[model samples]
Target: MKKVLVTGASGQLGKCFQKIASEYPEMELRNFNSSELDITDQNRLQQIFSEENPEYCINCAAYTNVEKAEDDEETAFKINAEAVKNLAEVCKNTGTVLIHISTDYVFDGKATNAYRETDVVNPINVYGASKLKGEEYIRQILDQHFIFRTSWLYSEFGHNFFNTILKKAEEGATLNITTSQTGTPTNANDLADFILQLIREENSEFGLYHYSNLGEATWYDFAKAILEFSGKIDQVTLNKSGYYKTRAERPTYSVLDKQKLQETFKKLVLHWRDSLEDLIINRFRKI
Candidate 1:
């Protein structure tokens, strides 16, 4: 069986991988939380790579706090950029393929059309710049890499936009979520499934890819969907993001073009609303 190593194993995306890993029997999967394996530490990564020699490494570890990253760029860069460089070095030496997760923030959010892999990147925030740096390291350091740039991922396994909205609904609170920023809300489970498909098929058509639920919506639209799904529409009044202040400068539009990934994988995609409904009603049952 092929061995796969998952870094940031305790995070939401990593846990999503763990939740469905059992159904596959052709691969032996091992995950490590930040406590067990800090990606920033090159020595620890070297030791792990020397021992496991994983055939595939899924890097789920990242500093994702968009606003918090503004105040602490050092920690963000360490985890998102320098750490990625270290991991890429090990993966290159060990002959392990790296699957690194990235974000839509790589684009400055001023585009009128969906962003393709070839689109020029201009990160306006620290988180975005840092993630872009990680991608650069992978490209420069390792050729065997698949960099997935996804947007607004949510799952039942961890803290995310969906959960936050659900909590607000439960408390009968009105929310003024951002209507200014627009992007797809991806289901983490769907993303995990796609990753496994790549592994199962051993697909080699690799580089940068965009995989997000089809259709675009602002944060306000997202909030409304969550409230509607939970039958709590009466509890919240969604408003434009301009009413609410955020520390980081978010892109006004950052939806990604999935044509490359869809055509390559020969896979059907889900709409943001459909995936959101499934998660709320089905509680993230495998889909």
Candidate 2:
């Protein structure tokens, strides 16, 4: 049986991978979060990898606190950049395929069109720069790898936009969301499914790819949709806020062009609204 090891198994995307892994009976799955395996500790990683000898290493671990990354640049780089380099080098030596998760923040949000896989990156914040550096490290050290760049990720297992809006609605609070910023919100489950498909297909020609649900929306639009979907649209008042500037400069328009993925995989995810509804009805309501 082919063995697959997933890092950051406690995260939203990692949980999604765990759920999808159940379908593959012929594949052995090993999962690890920060507590289980600290990628920054080279010796620890070496020991774990030596014992596991995984055929594929899906690296879902990352420092994703966007605003906090500004103050914690050293920690962020350690996880997002340095740790990635370590994993890529180990994967290269062990002849293991590495799947690295990245973000849309890598783009500067200056483009009028959706960013393609080949688009030049110009990160505007520390978090984005660190993730972009991780991508570069993977490219430099590993020959067989898949770098998936996604945006606005949410899931039932982690803190994200959808859960935040839901919490605010529960508190009977009016939320102020930015309408100027636009991008696609990707469900971690959909991304997990895509990763599973890629492994099954075993496409050797590896490179960067973008994955998100079909369509795009502003933060305001997404919040409104979430409220309406959760049957709390009447209670939530939507207000618009300007960019106003902050420690971490966010992209105004980081919508990724997923046509390359659509073309390559021939798989399309549901619209953000539809997926949000499904998540609420199935997962949030149960919790």
lDDT of 1 by residue, 103-155 (tens): 99999999999999999999999999999999999999999999999999999
Give stretches of model 1 more than 4 Å off: 284-287
| Pairs of residues at least 3 apart in sequence or in different chains that clash in candidate 1 | 178-241, 179-241
What tens-digit string does per-residue lDDT give for candidate 2 at 61-170? Answer: 99999999999999999999999999998898888999999999999999999999899999999999999999999998888999999999998777888889888988
**RMSD for each of the candidates:** 2.0, 1.7
- On lDDT, the candidate that comes out on top is 1
TM-score of each: 0.96, 0.95
Which ten contiguous residues of candidate 2 have the minimum total lDDT? Answer: 237-246
By summed lDDT, which 10 consecutive residues of candidate 1 come out lowest?
236-245
The reply for model 2, stretches above 4 Å from the true place, is 284-287
